[model samples]
Target chain A: MNPSNNNIETQDDIGTTGHEWDGITELNYPCPRWWVWIFLGTIVWAVGYWYIYPAWPVISGDSERGGTKGVMEWTQYKQLEESQSEIFSRRAENLEKLQNTSTKDVMDMPELYEFAVVGGKSAFKENCAQCHGSGGGGAKGYPNLNDDDWLWGGSLKELSKTIKYGIRSDHKNTRNSVMPPLAAVMGKDSVTKVSRYVAGLSKGSSSTAEGAKEYKQMCSACHGVNGEGNRIFGAPKLSDGIWLYGKGDEQQIESQIKSPQHGVMPAWIDRLGEDTIKQLVVYVYSLGGGE
Target chain B: MLEKHKKLEKNSILLLIFIIITISIGGLIEIVPLFRLETTIEPVKGIRPYTPLELAGQDVYIREGCYGCHSQQIRALRDEVERYGHYSLAAESMYDHPFQWGSKRTGPDLARVGGKYSDSWHVQHMINPQEYVPESIMPSYSHMATSKASLDDIGSHLEALRVTGVPYTDSMIENAYTDAMAQANEGEANTKDGLLKRYGKNTIVRDFDGKAGFVSELDAIISYLQVLGTMADLKDYNPDVVE
Candidate 1:
């Protein structure tokens, strides 16, 4: 490849052939030792790999042929499995601990939480990654697992209940909540009025004090007179910044109050298991909202 | 220019064939795997992956294309965390072998549906999905609960999963056998014995047989479901810790 090998000339630059063309010149820069080493290393490795693995062409070769099956017959899937086995073994230990220890204990212990987080990440990736994004970042309707805000409740028992029972799935224990629409009670404009009523609870600047008074009386029964929230009913805390439908768009809130929002989280008790649920709780709890 | 053009054309044709060959090979890899799956390892902590019967039920679920309407993933944002409790973690599905992070949400997400409902409700809902859900658009699976599902291959399914590496243990295997022999009504003892033996004697479950009692397949399904969000109450959930 080197025509210049014959003319071992030196350039002003550290490593190059001082070959000149017209006014411009070709500095025959032999690649760096590291560069050459890497290139040749790759070449040699490729050849070796080609021989050892299924790199050679086969018209209809299965995985064993023309693939990266090394001399040791190693493929990416096998490597992944090996690496995964290590993780699985580690998981076995954690699962063992989960079987013996209580979910509450798993929550309290930092080590268990750490274990829970690692397991949770893999499990989430496998089971919950699609809709939740890679790390439970959430989409339009889905809720995030990382935040402190909870729909059913954030406490261990509450979270467990939510996971086990789910929300509004046909499961017998499922939690059910509905806003019933202020429009149903009154009218759509009244929805805006009621939204203002709900808004008034946060800072007391709602346009309708009478509405707020009504809120303290009617809404307070479930939302708390202060408009905070009632966990039992899954009534979201009105004072909090995390709005499920949207932020405090007075119009939207008004519409929502007029109409209301109903979100559902399916019950899992019929799918996974109690221990798995507890592990999931620990995993979810470790996601940043447990305490 | 003509000679050069011919040479260029020749080279381009060669490149095109090579590219086509490469593309075909890549496509075939995916196609072939769809028919054959590797035996997966069950988590050594004693929880085996879903057995074929249970897996069949799940497949019945997947084929009925339940995922089209329901999503399985949960997010980790504030409201989601608040609503679903904590964000879903990664460890809950370590033994899934082929994890089921579903997409779409015409209905709700089912990442954690274990132990949430009584078995009879599941049966009733399957028979008449809309009876339980007044506004539901889901198809019914009542026949699945009522039919004499082929339980013969369940052992092979477990062994197949065992071949892959899911840890079923002696008792789990035993439970599978004993449960197989019992009348449908008497499956609870077998399920309990199996779970106790496999999970160990100390596992705490106040209502392991809530209402409908335990059927091994149902137990297996519920075991897979009951755990969704109950992991830990996070003091802090920093993503940086993952590396």
Candidate 2:
């Protein structure tokens, strides 16, 4: 059979392209009417969307007129602004109360105290939980908020002050102190004897005569005579079980005495603002550690 | 129209050519706007190029796949702004050859982490993330502290970055190794002064790893992490104006 003759006719009485393989004919069918209408509808919707949003770029390249400015004048930033404004307006009264009231007096009002605690809890999670544990259990150097040991006094007022200015931060009002590496100043052997004496001070064990003599000469100025610790110096009471840097072990104490790693807490005043700080102060004070 | 369609479908080479043209239209629409990228990024002050040490740290960050868990880009949302300070600007990542504007955030955003914590805190967090943050699922990178940072190839690294439109000066490229060493060991008067002279007075010159003498990978990575979103000063930017 001639290849040209195969395109002449088909067995079935239907429209065909005359393209057949092994006597199988092909029929050309139009697209479904509903599907075609829906497709057209989508194109119309797309065009309408283009007109209603920043869509097609213009040739001019000017940002203002670069793309089609919809009548809505909407942006992601604008949406965020609106939502934030709504939130601020809703909490305006409570926020004002939080700002005006003293951190210590905040606990007097039940509702305000609850609000502050809730706010502070979230703020703590975002800001404080990174260095301090999620439960405020404190890290190796970072202070534990749940313990009764006071590094820089655990009172609500003191907590507020510490949180505001921070300890050894760049903030001018920061609670500044320097625990000089005693090894450099008092010789290595004295530091060891002093470490042993300081470790024994909290454990109800009496220091050796040699250790006691060394402690008075080098450590009494900041740590106090009996290792009671001075708040002004930001020194910890050596008699307590709470060790800021490590587990109150002999080696850890010796290492600390050799080269003290002064813990630095950033002043949250610039970052978190006063109201949040007050709330954080109240929350931290309520954590069973406040003096 | 039917005959034309039938003829077009029958010709494979013609169909291929038409397909190419159709796809090219989409490709051009997507790619052409990048040619005018300068217009896209807002003008912001204090967005300087990364110092050699920070650049090396950034290389370490990329190598360790830190971007897999953390995102650098903070969207202009109320919650994000409240938590992560200001929203990230395109100008901040302008000098980055392949920017670290990651999408996922398994860990917190590192956009404004600089100056939030001290160098020792970063060192501790890097060595064992769970030590400070007990709930943290991040893996320990204790090995980074022990590993010494290779400073010999730092000059070449600066040259490579300079080729990708980073404004690294001839002197900066030449003194990249020393500058990195100086930034890590700020106690050394000569190197510290040299670093300040080359990188600018604002350069953070200190032992980032808390270990005074030796420069380690931990130091480089901590430097990079610390300076994540601190470069671009967004003080004058009024978000309301854009809105």
Candidate 3:
């Protein structure tokens, strides 16, 4: 085929190849010089990439060793360790301070308190926020950390002990208590009467509900004569009206009297170490409800 | 060379063969490594098969589509490691017939939720997630508390898992029903030793759902959740060894 014999002309005037089907001709469009170079460059780059990274599996005798461990020998765990070490180095001063100071003493040091609060906030979100509200607002069954109504005392030492060992937890030294179902031992009528009297105490109405005698005999061992809760037994202050289960209505009170629900908090000492627990104590104490 | 190419293009069979060969290079690169999975998975100690109760609970987990919200695999990123304990290991889910290393995280990663909360917390959380976690979008599984776990098919389930390399022994399969019951009724003394003998001593035995008459679906699921990433003691884990 001759160039002069063509009726159509391309913009670049590039010649067509001698291949044709029907009336159409195959144009000899050369790829851009830069693109052709880049195409070949990527092939070379791929070989280098494979060499630098764990790319191909290697079979040695009967076993298959995962891959060539790369020239950089980069493992994800190593990267994680590197990043974590960076964080650790940055917080080394605070971490040391946190370790040295007791949880109670952490409050006195402004710098330490700030460090602990920050650390404890993140730790609480990870661990405690699920049960205890994100802002320390207690849920229906869970106790509120923002109020002075503490079931097992709210002093820094008390809070620290509770946080460390946990209430009704599996920990060997867990603050354990059980309010046995009174309906079985005492008659159901007596339980209802006692519940009504207890409910009346929180309402500020000194009603002589018939269960006052039963309350003194059975419940007063843990709950005081005036319904003040005992920290030793972890009994709630009935007079304060801060209910842990349901609203302290007559029915709710009666249900609790029948079969009390015991809440369990896992021991955090095994999980969050003493330093973290100390930090948590400072953070909790700072939450306004701390005694 | 141009004329030779024209001849090659004209022959469809030859073109097809070349296309196959070209595609196979990419295909082989992606697939052949999977055949050597033994090498790819690092050897880690203390990764054991799920006990009968745990396996049953895992079935409940699958049935409920818990993986839709919760991811079991924690990535190798720093933030994820700090939040969800150690990054997940392949050996951890080796026994998982269909692994639950989910992609979407509607809920937090459950890779290391084991022993994080008490059994009672799990019971409450499962009954009503919003009651414990007000911000949680998780649905209530309160019905599970009432429904009894199916003990009849437990042995057959173990046998099926055995077919997929779970290493459930014949005796384990035989006592699967009893073992599931024993796990839920921890107070029963006779079945305790047998369960311990079968599934290591570290196996947690308790009335997980705080109910006793029959093993509830709640018990199975709680048992599964309680043992999620507690298998391996990561302190002894050496990530340097790729074996």
Candidate 4:
């Protein structure tokens, strides 16, 4: 059979190109007029989009940096800058208040406090919510924000300082402290005894006479005589049930004493500006545990 | 036009040739510009090659398909800039062999995740992501904490990266294994000092996995995560001044 024999004519006098298959003819219909028009319209739109946005690589000239910069000079960076400007304008008043007012004054002013809390909540979700929970409940190593138990003081001033400089961060003014690994210095037996004594403080369990002696000699300097902890040294109170690194169990306490995990919080002063940091301070304070 | 199309369609060889030419045009347009990649990437300060340990961690990250969920690219958007610090620059990922500019963000963008959380936080988060972020849908990688990272192939890995334009020196390649060990254990004074000298003064030398006496996969991963977007000096970066 001829290759073109399948091209056949139809009954309606709408001639097909002499093609047929099993008593049927294929209709060689013209492309839909609307569809063709829309296709052409899309091409036009694309050309317009290219003209208005960075498109096409440079072929010859050094002046053509990489791509053809559109007539409007629109870029993702420029778009971001414009949006940031708009946001800045909107928050100008609140930002100004945050910058000027003291940490105490921020809490006193209801409107400013509300503004800070709202802004800080979103900021915390973005910055601190990964390790510290969305609600600031905190994980094993991370400090819970909602509790009164603060390794550093819970006061607004202390929180502001902590947020600005961070704990053991690279920041110059970072709240630096190291709970030295006592297992090496105190020996395994003494470290275990101290761990037991520290754990028993919170539970009100009677510490072994040997453990009590070891606790006074090895742990008391920074952890305090009564195990109340010293905020100046960034030590957690042993008497408090709250443990930053682990749960207050025998194994957990022993592991912590043996090889202490020092938490490092990145400084927000460099990342988030002073105004935002102040707002964060107020927000953290409003988490219902601040002094 | 219909007659010309019919003629071309009838000749298989001619159609094949035309198809090859059409495909080549697209291929040339895409591949040719890569030759001028140096000019295309903006020159930026503080963008250094990854250390041996960080490189090992990056390998582990890829192995675990961390990029499947976490994006290394922070797009120049107001919200992204506000949340994830500065928008990610092309130069920031210049040394990345297979870039981690992921499309899907099941988790947050990890471009600026370095130094954001503590080492212990990272360790705990990796061991169990939900333990920290209650709402996080991320899977646990607790095995990494116990598993010992193989340092035997690190020197070769460095050499391979060097061949692919990572600027890993002969000295760096030679000391790659020792440097990986040193970076994880601060007690190794000689090797730790050597690591700092080779990499930089800013190289964080400590037991990353919280467990002493062993350098686990957890240490490498933590080291890698801790230095994600911290390499680039964004303080001096002027977004308005396009290089």
Candidate 5:
């Protein structure tokens, strides 16, 4: 066959797409072999995917009817349940042991203690770490778990109770205390004097401070006669330097005395279930502050 | 096949028609299921439409672009379930008009942030997030505290949402402004009783922004935040059994 003839009309000839731009004809070459194979492969894969997974919508009056259940009969919730069950199964033995063991007895079982600590640390990071620091060092108002100071007691049983029924939480059994605004009850001047007296207590000042008289008259009941905190009232130990609102300076003390700000922690029993709370109590105890 | 294709390729309208048909096949498959299927949303109790104040707050949430950083949907994954609590149910946000199931998560999921913190904590966090959370990148919304919530057109908003299938009663629309005010000043003598009567008893009516007189934008937002996932009592829901 002649080259010119083949180019124009012969069966052996390559063809143009019958279009021209600036006197150049477009070639109508087939797609690349790999590209065509991949394109076809994707279509086949998609068909397989649709067959194995939910793909089509079916009309059904029943609210439970989602769609056409593929051969795999898989769902996101089922996948989550399976994955979560795997995790639970892995921890089941330890969790059951911890569940059986009382909060006080958890300390005695070293293996269970280690499990609780690890589990509790993870749970705390997910929940409590946002408010209380990740290291349990505590923010200004948030109580530090690592320190000996606790608004409530620091024993394992106390920690568990506090964690379950939070201080000033909405829980019916939540620990409650109210230091009536001293500035409102007594004069502002008296509040200032009392604040100075309380501030001086942590500094080891002489008991005969300027506001010593006011302290005995107004604040002695809940905050003991010597500024020692009363656990019953969840009051801060005044002898120590730890302050919930701010640094225990005169101004901070004065501000707190004038308008007492009660820190609120959410009750975790409903949120974190009993088993998890048990683990958390142990974890917090291991943080070096358990009494 | 090559010879037959030349006739169709030569015609622009035919090519366009074929393209439309190709695209519609994918679109119909993806979208039709959502409407046709009955179980797209699980049937759970207590999933009600937002109260007027909460609705106003939702508008504020959208206006301020809270969805830019915070996603309301928690995926059904092990970590997400463990962290955010029970994997988010479809029914949890079924009443959401343009659901705030955001794709991006610059901040943590706000799916079950309701009842997680106290009203005061929410107020403080909103005012200055960095003060409480030292490493937070969230900006302060202190301006919302001072800015009064716009309640004048709240009825119209309810009406608009009503047209889009939300079951807003005529009385609810009429009492929209009062209800917004009532929600913010909960404990005052007779204000909240009507609100509680209208919305469910579980509706938490409180001084969300710590200001009682007028409904501030902060109050609206906080009220909205406080009600996020507190609605559906999850104990009644069991995932293992499909209902």
Candidate 6:
């Protein structure tokens, strides 16, 4: 090593500290080289990222040139639209046929039946499932669509009629018969006798004298002479043990005969198309009673 | 004074930013429509809608606010299965616009209650709530038992409902002809064809005996009641594989 006169011949092992603090202490040190590189890279990437996506709140409308449209211009709303379209395409073919075909033709297509089943389940959920459960099972006063016993006939045709022309609703051309209030027609006391006699019908017992006459004139019109229910009227068989609201004990029957009952189903023609209703009929029919 | 105040402001500003960011994250998570799973069923499956009359009964149920006490859905709990039936399937309420998974257990669930009672029974119960069940919280809807309807419409209106998605077909529309004949027998001259043209050919009526005309909207409503919970096809609907 050279003596103090030659500057290039210095032999210090460590690098220089730009500033000296208090004699021998040093103040400066370079950060690690890798760290410096990464830091710079991140800053650069951020600038590019900001340019590409809508990372910032947008204030401009569609007219701005470079005012918005963060380079890619992608949006969640658009992504949702695209995904929905993809799902819709799978349904489109079936739905198209449905919209075009008459419901009768729709029924003939067993494959369409399969499609209808799939479609009907969801439609039923949206349209009929509120009163009828997801599976067409009903509640205390509500009738189950999945059962073999139908107040109305269980045939697809019969089911369809019921759906199209709802009962007791304000719908135009609604199904019409009204149970005259027994109290309205028969004096209050007669109601008791009639209800009891009507109760006897379920047991296949003869109606009391007053009941026999009232049954012939009033009840037999819908309930049938033998007390078997008219599926057409949706009147239940008197004999069946299955009670919707309750069974025909003396008071129960008296209350019923005194006042005819009203149950209501909303119309679905405008809500669910005819084919879908038919499909629901098929689905319901397929559930318990096909015969 | 300016320097001291600026220092204080800086400290508060940083605190505010941290709080805002934390709250924003929490808000976002809560806003998401957290999808939950109960049971599994294919999204697009088929089953029949209730008939017009049966559908009418459902309308009656709703009109009377039966949904308040009775739920059509049976939960997956053991008590529900025992009290109602098998667990209420998602498939059961698929067609319902507003599912009737009742909020309370005031009355038993009627998920599978169609044909569970005779028409007269329903009639009686509606007339006097306590007549059948010694202890019932329901108020008798005796008004429904009479022709004095709180609401109207049973056929064409149902056609409108059919548009909602309960399933109607052309043959069913033709049945309107037989239905019209039945209506005639019931003392109305309207033919199914005439009704069909107006309600559109898809109108469905379940009164197979063609005794439709005599059926007031009330009869139709009762018909709706008659068809509840009848969809028990173990073969078509294999419970084991429904999921």
- Best TM-score among the predictions, by candidate number: 2
Candidate 6 global lDDT: 0.58
lDDT of 5 at B91: 83
Error of 1 at A28 (Å): 55
Q: How high is each candidate's TM-score? A: 0.40, 0.89, 0.87, 0.86, 0.88, 0.44
- Poorest stretch of ten by lDDT in candidate 1 chain B: B37-46
* Global local distance difference test of model 4: 0.84
lDDT per residue as tens, model 3, A171-231: 7899999999888888988888888898899988886667899999889989898899898
> Candidate 6 residues A156-225, lDDT tens each?
6777777776665546856656556667777776677767776776666653555677666777778787
List, residue by residue over A6-106, the lDDT tens digit for candidate 2: 64344335587656668876776668999999999999999888878767655553453235557776767788888899989988899998888877778
Point out the higher-scoring one by lDDT: 3 or 6. Answer: 3
- Any idea what lDDT model 3 has? 0.86
Between prediction 1 and prediction 2, which has the larger TM-score?
Answer: 2
Per-residue error for B72 in candidate 4, Å, reads 1.8
The recovered share of true contacts, given per candidate in order, is 0.00, 0.60, 0.83, 0.71, 0.71, 0.00
Best by lDDT: 3
Query: Which order, best to worst by TM-score?
Result: 2, 5, 3, 4, 6, 1
Clash pairs (backbone) in predicted model 2: none
What ranges in model 1 sit over 4 Å off?
Answer: A1-90, A108-110, A129-133, A137-139, A203-210, B1-243
Model 5: lDDT of residue A150: 78
lDDT of 4 by residue, A1-291 (tens): 356664445234666754444667666677899999999999999999899988877666543456788899987778888999999999998888778888899788999999999999998888888767788887767788898888899998899899999988888999999988888888888877777777789887774455888888888899998889999989888897888766797888899888776778888887788877877888888998899
Tell me the deviation in Å of residue B215 in model 6: 32
After TM-score superposition, what is the CA distance of residue A264 in candidate 6 from its true location, in Å? 2.3
Error of 4 at B51 (Å): 1.9
Model 6 DockQ, alpha carbons vs. true complex: 0.02
Which candidate leads in DockQ? 3
